[model samples]
Target: MKDFVSVIITAYNRQKYLGYALNSVLNQTLDKDKFEIVVITNFEFNKPNYKNIIDIYDNQEYLGEKIYKGLHESKGDIICLLDDDDMYREDKLERVTSFFKTFYPIYYHNNFVTIDDKGNEIKIIEEYLKIPPYASFNLPEFTLAIENNRKTDIRNLLKLNVNFNSSSICVRREILENNAQYLRKIKAVIDSFIFYSSLLLEGNILLDPARLTYYRIHTLQTSSGNTKNIKEYKDSFSNLFKKAVEDFYIITEMLNGKINENILEIVNEELLRYKLLYKIFSGNNILIKTKFNIHLLNYYLLSLLPTFLGNLYIKDQYNRTKKVRSFQVKSSNIF
Candidate 1:
């Protein structure tokens, strides 16, 4: 029998957290027969002989392909994603199922709590996501309105450009299958791909404010695993930018390169921000040829002015910095 929800858990060799992540699903308040656990991993791990039938797909492939494989194999109409290092709250599946039924959103992202490697919750933390615009009182969730033109939809979503934790992501199966092309190219920026594709395909997105998943933070993540200095930091930022650029390119292909006008304008601004920061910190020449928006006035000055003047500005900022070792060099002048 087809399940109502397929909780697809993508894992690697992390034996430590996989059990906890799986147990979280097993412990869900939802009926065990209503939802099935689909484990996709490269290696064969211990699968608990539980009442809920858990299917395993063991293969070695890249991140995108692995996700595609799981999506292809899931038997449920509603797909819920759980990363290997993350765990879901016991009520998450129940809430997510109801959220989809009422809102009928193609993509759904619930809020999540950040936890350490030891499962301790972290408070007062800086987060990667912004509060979704449409989520408000009484509603307490977000649903993107696509009442405008395609260009407007693209522009507004790209402007917002908010991404949440992967484990908190859920979607209707057909939307993901129809847009699997975008998923194929994605490696590490899965959240961005899912988000942009949902908007690109004109599917409504729902963002729930409820914390339904536990997003694990550790020193093992690729971006923070081995970063040592400003140079490494620059490299890491560059890598992340590259991944996002790939997503943009995939979108361009989807639109047959027609939205090139301002589609990449936001991405280009982010690139300039990185280059501008790198030059200021490394004592190098700022890329004066690149353009910046009005909000980035200090960056605009750094690029528009002469090379020597830009260097002086960098030096000035460096001198005023409270701690150079901390990479907390303060912002540059505006006027």
Candidate 2:
């Protein structure tokens, strides 16, 4: 198992938690000689004692450039992302390598825990993964069929929650090499795009229930649980919705001209719903209604044909969001 994996850390000015992350990788159960740690960092701290650190720097203007620099510099058969603020359990490498050997999945994971800025333990992510919608749709059967035919299930998979946590995932190098050009094109949240694309295109996925990594949350971080003012919350939701739409379009285009009408209708309908919800939540009637494709308009009209359909939709959306936040709370206790 000599030089079997490459661990890439895209770090900025977060020095407080960097040591724990670096130590986690260095303390892995696998042989120290078997893996290399390539850190793409801008912060100039005393480097760790690890022998294999391949540190590089970027202009710091864009976060993605820092990650791109690291990804290009690293040379390993298997690649894993370890944010400077996150830590991996000692057994993470062992489990990841073992799982990858047996299952040729685009992505593999164990479990992830979140830690607050104060370093309090959070809950595990696996416990929060809502069981996919199954009653109304034969999703498992469809997934299996796609796998059997060696085709990508880009549509159905994206409709489900994003499963890959950047710090918890290990991907094959060939996949990265093949998608390098596409990866560079993405401007925001490159890890999410890469993980989603991999999961959509590659069928074999492994999920071990054991917690193996810690995702840190801090007030300075955009995606943390830090309390925000009304304006901040509005801005955050707006960004989230914009990214969701962008990801949807990207996935839809990637299906090689094979469009699934049912999924298209569902996604378009949901996007419009989300837009309307955002406007209402922000108490801003000035926001224009989202323009949707013909399929979405039909779905909207059909839903509204029944009395109080709009009210019910809003109520259900709130309830579902509550469930997701509840899951997030429960998941925050895992470290």
Could you tell me which 10 consecutive residues in candidate 2 have the lowest summed lDDT? 129-138
Off by over 4 Å in 2: 1-3, 60-63, 123-164, 199-203, 224-228, 240-335
lDDT of each: 0.60, 0.56
- Please write out the lDDT profile of model 2 over residues 140-176, one tens digit for every residue: 2221212321344544544433344567667777656
Best by lDDT: 1
Cα shift from native, residue 289, model 2 (Å): 10
Write the residue-wise lDDT of candidate 1 on 20-139 in tens digits.
999899999998878988888777778889855565666643456677878777689888888888899999998877767776777777777656556766542222211121211122
